[model samples]
Target: MPVVFIHGVATRAGEQYQRGVAAREELIRRLLVDRMAASDPRWAGMQVVSPYWGDLAVRHYWAQATLPPVGTLEDMGVGDDGVAAADLEVADLVKEIGNDATGLEALGAETPLRNAWSKNPHRTVEALLAPIVHSDRSVLRPQDLGITEQARPAQALGEIDGRVLAAGSLAASDEAVGAAIRDALSDDAALTVITDAIVARTEQVAPVEASTDSALESLGPGWLDTLRDRVGEVLNRAKSAPARVATLAALDRYRDGLHGHLTLFMGDVFVYLLRRGEAGSPGPIVERVREAIADAPRSRADEPLIVLTHSMGGNIFYDLVTTYEPSLKVDLWVSAGGQVGQFEEMKLFKASTVVDPPAPPMPPKVAALGGRVRTWLNIYDPADILSFLVEPVFTDPDAGVRIKDLKFKSGVSALKAHGAYYSRPTFYELLGREFGSRP
Candidate 1:
């Protein structure tokens, strides 16, 4: 059976190294073998294939000769000069924002997504980095800490400022002029923009001491309230950039804003997802997917043709099925960290029919189910900014092909959660259940 894999957008180099695909593939194989119960005939030979599409985006950037700001995503766990590096990054972004020559161009050729500062470099660095940053998770959420509305942590700026400075994160010269960059990095915003770099600066292990716990209680009755308040204050301070830019209410909103911008194709795939447009010719991503499946071990009647996808790879897959509607027999379509859910607002595109549910699966059904896909499983992390739920559109109860959305947690924090999918229990469970023995 041919098992095809597709990846999501911004699959940076660090993720590949951190996961070590060869080793990960072996781990998957073993998991399937162990879970198979040694009784299933189908378990004889089923391999997990993970396609690397990161290089495509990377290559595109290079072809344009436009070097995107690539941070060193080292695995060094919050040690040494990591905090210093983060500080430097903030400083660099500030400089870039202040300087007219270094402004983020109108259309970044790499991902070609829209940027508030796309045309205006001097506006604020945060606008350009909005989609890439992961600061949304850390801010707001007053209920998490049981903090009352009257004493909301929105005014905790003083405490947050002290803690951030003590951490040695922001330094002199650089600290003086940080408007857009400061706003973005102010609260986990930095986490999204410079993922690997932030990881290296952050501690991998849990905190040994309750250093902040007592201090938090001192601030208020609930620790979550205290922490949230402090960060809220910092985010407020971040918004108070010298001149131009947005004044954010909470960092999470800014954090949440980046998700859609990341998918801007120099165009909108959402429109097609919303309103069925004329079937146009395929693009570069199409050619790539076509080639990938073509080169994969050919699928057979007895063999299950399973395709696993992640992030933007799912978007590409969406485009693939919607436009090309390839005459290939697809068995299981598993998407993780996918944006297809965002693309399909009201229409369902499963079983080769655009099912606008509450209504029957739409008309203009495929001529036959011979080449149509069977099942689709979507997996996502609540904390992951880049991913979305795809079950609504792709899952049609009438299609007879099962489509389910599973919320998976990788136990990773910040933007790194987007890349931490491979190491999750969900990863193992899905593979084992699909390729291994049932029951």
Candidate 2:
């Protein structure tokens, strides 16, 4: 059977190849296997395929920037030391700049890889944009969109830490370091807006001499020239301000767009998915998905197309399948924490004949999906803010699209619930029963 997993944002090209991606797939395999009584063989050989579309967004912005690749901080001689020094620089900046004490406090409380976000996302945004404020207009321009990348604030802070490290002055005030970076990155239009807002608040903007004195001698002459050339390349990007505005808007669409930068679960997936066009906004990624899953083997007659989707992934598939409509028949659709429930109400999907009270569930003997699918199950955590009852919108007894909604109550908090359904045992058990692999 074709077991396709549609992933949400963040799983960018490089990111999808990381350890966490492998771990999730491994766990899914284990979950499928564990559902059987150690005797079933049907699901034993099943493989899960997750198509990563995160690179689309990165590709979209990079196409416009047209600058050469940015070598790592390690190559620049800044190295991994920036991670440790970044904390120190942040403390200094917070104390000196008087940016956002609440956001800083939240950052301190947050876990690693998840620290830069605040309880108030908008306020945190302000703090991140505070340092670059200058005159009526901030020194940071829309062109700086490229600098936000995967981790905007944290990455921006680390970039400043690199300058501090190269300066050979661990003792330099956070204010001085921020100012130095602002000046050095001035021509580099790809600079992050959050970084500027943060650095601008520092009391003093240090001159290049103040930070680069000793390091400049060891670095030789061409390094500064290369930096200048890169700056020019960044500024010369042909795309106008509208592109930048669209990019920022894209950043705000998925998971309220917070997952792209703040959360570990998502990345730049929305950046490309949100690019609008005459045809459709997600037309690009949707086409890419069609190509990836086009070759699933049809070796077994009993096997039907099986789709497991979560969060934004479900939305993507819903659009794809809905567009194809009655022509597309998914044998089994396993949706968790998805927005599939709202499609009809949003006018994205038109209801068929307004079947008064939704047709109630039928017996197993009645068959499902017009005898095409064994079941259509949706498992979700009640606390997950993203989850909703699909029965109201998806149930169509006439079309044989039966939606069975089940709640998984294991979540400790609303925020934590969105990602927990994947590992929920009840979810796996339901899958096993529906597949008839277990008693």
lDDT of 2 by residue, 147-242 (tens): 333333322222222232112112122344334444443223223332333233221212223221122232223333233233222223211211
TM-score of 1: 0.45
| TM-score of each predicted structure versus truth | 0.45, 0.45
- State in Å the error of residue 55, model 2: 1.3
- Which candidate comes out best when scored by lDDT? 1
Q: After superposition, how far is residue 50 of candidate 1 from its true place, in Å?
A: 3.4
The global Cα lDDT (0 to 1) of model 2 is 0.42
| Candidate 2, position 62, lDDT | 47
For model 1, the stretches where C-alpha displacement exceeds 4 angstroms are 12-19, 33-39, 58-281, 298-301, 346-371, 397-399, 430-439
C-alpha lDDT values of all predictions: 0.43, 0.42
Candidate 1 residue lDDT tens string, 1-439:
6556675554444422322443334333443432552765454456555566454442342443333343333342322321222222232343343334343331112211112223222222222221112222222333544544434243232222222221212111133223433456233453233322222222211121232221133444333334434433433333222112211122233233244335443223443344333345554555667667767663234766667776767766765665565556676777887777765553344324455453545333233223366777788888788688754444443546666787775433443567555433235555556555432
